[model samples]
Target: MYFFLSHLSVCDILISTNVTPKTLQVLLTGRHLLSFSSCHTQLYFFGAFTGTECCLLSVMSYDRYLAICDPLHYSFIMKRHLPQFLATLCWLVGFFVSMIIESFVVALDYCGPNVIDHFFCDLTRLLELSCSDTKMTDICVTIIVSIIGIFQVVFVIVTYICIFTSILQISSITGRQKIFSTCSSHLAVVSTYYGTLIALYVAPSSGHFQTLNKVLSLLNTIITPLLNPIIYSLRNKEIRSAFSKNVLRRLKR
Candidate 1:
C-alpha cells in the first residue's frame, strides 16, 4: 500500500509540477509570458515531460506484457533494479532530446503577434504564434514527434498484438477468457491514452483540430490519473480483494 501510494505521488508530481512555474509567469505578465528565453524554457520542459510520459507508458505496457504473456520469466526480465535503470535513462534521453528541439525554436526570433493560442505551453502552438521564420522549428518538431510519439505508439501496438496473440494460443476456453480478463483493463487504458496522444501530437495541427487537441489533451492529462485507480480497483481481482479486506478489517475494529 505504501509503495503504491509513493509511486502515485511521484506520478502526480511529474504531471502537475510543470504547471506551477508557467502559471506564476502568466500571472506576473498578465497572460503574455512569451519572452524569448521563457518560451525556450517552457518548450524544453514541455517536450521533455511529454516525451518522458510516452516512454514511461510504453515501458509500463511492456511490463504488463511480460507479466501476462511470460509470467515465468517476468521477474528475471524486469527486476526492480532494471526498471529503475530504464526510468532514469528515459528521463535523461527525454531531457536532452527536448533541449535540442527547444534550441532550434529559440534560434528563430518572434517579430510580432506572440500570442500563443493554446492554454498550456506546447511546441506547435508556440510555433504558430511565432511571427519569424519558423520553418526550422516546424521541421524539428515534426522529426521529434515522428521519432518519439509515432515510434512509441508503434511499439505499444506491437506489444498488444503479441499479448493478444499469446492469449489466443491458450487451448481451453476458460483459460483464454481468464487471460483476456487480466489484460482487458490495461488494453482499455492503453487504447485511450495512446489514442488521445496520437490525436494531440501526430495529427495535423490546424485551427480546425485545435478543439479536438485540447479535448484529447485534457483526457490524457486530467482524466487518466483519476481513471487509473478506479480501473485497477474494479478490474483487478487482487486490488479488489485488498480493498475489501482493508474495509472489513476497519469495520471489525
Candidate 2:
C-alpha cells in the first residue's frame, strides 16, 4: 500500500507541477500567449500524467482488492517486485498513449489565431487552433479515452465491489471498519478525480459550460494534487505517524 501511495503521491505532484506554473502565468498576466512548441510540450505532459493517474488508480484498487479480499494470500500474490512492475507499467502505458495523441496534435499546422481559451495547453483546446481536419484527432482521442479512461474506471468499480463483498464476510465489526477506512481514502480520491474528468470529457456537450469546465479542469490538475497528500496522510495512520516523526520531530529538535 505504501509503495503504491508513494508512487501516486509523486505522480500527482509531478502532474500539477508540469501544468500549474504556466497556467498561473497566464492567469496572472491575462495573456494567452504560448509558443507552438511550448503548447505541444505542455499538452504532451498533461495528457501523459492524466492517463498515468487513471491507470495507477486502477492498480491501487487492485492492490486494495488483494489486501482486503484475499488477506490470507495477499503477501504471496502481491510480491516484493509486483508493485514496482505495476507502477512502471502504468508510467510506460500512460506516456505511450499521450505520445500517440500528441503526435496527432504535432502533425497539424496552426494557421493563425493561436490563442487558446484554456489556461494551459490541452489536446482538446489545441485542436481548436488547428487549421487542418480534426476528424482523425477526435477519433484517436475518443479511442484512447474509451480504452484507458472508461475501462479503468469500470475495473476499479468492479474491484471495489468484490472488496465490499469480502468485507461483508468478515465476522468482526473492527475488521470491517478497518478495511473500510483503509480503502475509503482511495475511493475518495478516485471519485473526485474521475468525477471531474467524466464531467469534463464524457458528459454530453449540448450545453457547454466553458467557464465552469475550465474551473473543474484546474481542480483536476491543481487542487487535486495539493489535496492528495493531505487526504492520504489524514486517513493513513502510519503515514501520519511517520510524517510527525520525520518532519515535526526535526523541527522541534
Candidate 3:
C-alpha cells in the first residue's frame, strides 16, 4: 500500500510540476516541434497516476473508517494481506479507467488553436484548446469526473459521517474525546482535500470564478500534499512518540 501510494505521489509530481506549463507554452505558443506520440504519452501517464490517486484516497478513507468505526474487527479484516490485495485492485481499476478516458481525448484530432490556457495538461483545459467540436469530450470528461472524483468525495464524506456519529454516541465523555482525537487528523486532511477539489472543479466554471478556481487548484495540488504529513504527525500521538524515540536513539548513538 505504501509503495503504491508513493508511486502515485511521484506521478503527481511529474504531471503537476511547473515544467509542464513551460513545455506546454513552448509547444503551443513558440512553434516548438511536438510529436503526436509524446503528447499521447503525457496524457496517458498523467491520467493514469491521477486516477490512481483518487482511488487510493477513497481506499484510505475506507480504511480509516473501518479502523475508527469498527475497531473490533479492523485487525482481523484489514490485515496486511487484505490491504495488499485492495491496493492492487485500486491501481488496476484506476489505470484502466484513465486509459479509457485518455483514449477518447486523443481520438479527437487537433486542427488549430492548440493554446492551452491552464498551467497543466488537464483534460478540461486540453478540451478547451482543441479545434474539434469538444461537446462530446466535455460531456464525457464531466461524467467520468463526476463518477470518479465526485463519487469518491461523497463516499468519504458519508463514511466519515457515520464514523463521527459513532464517536459522538460513546457514553463516556473521555471516551468520546479520545475517539475524536483519534479521527480528527484524518477528518482535517479529508476536508482540506475535498473542499479545495470541489471548489476548483465541481463549481460552476465561469470568468468570475477563474481566479478563485486557480487559487484553489494550486492549494489543493501543492499545499495539501505538504500539509497532510504535518497534520497527521502533529495530531497523532503515537506517531509523535515514535518519532521522538527514534530521534533520541539516534542522538544517543
Candidate 4:
C-alpha cells in the first residue's frame, strides 16, 4: 500500500505543481494571461496526472481487496515486481490518454477571443475557446471519461463490495472493526476525489454555475492535494511519531 501511496503522492505533486504556480501568478500579479503553448502544456500535464491518480486509486482499492480478502496469499499475489509494473502501467496509460486528447485540442482552430474563463487551462474551458468544430473533442473526452473515470469508480465499488463480504465473514468483532477502519480512509479519499470531479465534469447543468464549477475545480486541484497527506499519512502512527520527534522537537529548540 505504501508503494501505491508513494505514487499517489507523486501524482498530487504533479497536479499541484501544474496548476498552482500559474494560479498564484495570476492572483499576485492580477494578470490572468497565459500564452498558447503554456496553456496547452498545463492542460496536458493536468489531464495526465488526474488520469494517473484515478487509475492509482482503483489499483489501491484492488490492493486492499487482496490484502483483506486473501491475506495469506496477498504477498504472493502482489509479488515484488507487480506493484512497480502496475504503477508504471498507470503512468503510461495516463500519458497516452492525455496525449490523444491534447492532439484533438491542438487540431482545433482558435481564431480569436482566446480568453479562458478558469484560473488555469482546463479542457472544457479550452474547448469553449476554439472556433473549429468541438464535436470531435467532446466525443473524445466523453469516451476517455467513460472508460477511465467511470470504469475505475465502478471497479473500486465492486472491489470494496467483495472486501466487505470478506470482512463480514470474520468471526471476531475486533477483527471486523479493525479491517473496516483500514478501508474507511481509502473510501474517504476516493469519495472526495471522485465526488469533486463528477460534480465539475459529469454533472449536467448550464453556464450559470460556471463560477461554482471554478470553485469545484479549485477543490479538485488545490484542496485535494492539501488533504491527501493528512488523510493518508498523518494519522499513521509511525508518521506521527516521526513528526513529533523530528519536527516538533526542532521547534522546541
Provide the overall lDDT of each model, using Cα atoms, as 2-decimal numbers: 0.71, 0.86, 0.71, 0.89
Pick the winner on lDDT between candidates 1 and 4.
4
**Candidates ranked by TM-score, best first?**
4, 2, 3, 1
Give one digit per residue, the lDDT tens place, for model 2 in 147-229.
87768988999999999999899899998998899899999999999988988785443347767768778889998888887
List all candidate RMSDs to the true structure: 4.9, 4.0, 5.3, 3.1
Per-residue lDDT over 179-216 for candidate 3, one digit per residue giving the tens place of the 0 to 100 score:
77766776787788778877777665557876676667
TM-scores vs. true structure, each candidate: 0.77, 0.90, 0.78, 0.92
In terms of TM-score, the best-performing candidate is 4
* Deviation of model 2 at 93, angstroms: 0.4
lDDT of 2 at 180: 96
Estimate candidate 4's alpha-carbon lDDT, on a 0 to 1 scale: 0.89
> Rank by lDDT, descending?
4, 2, 3, 1
| Model 1, TM vs. native | 0.77
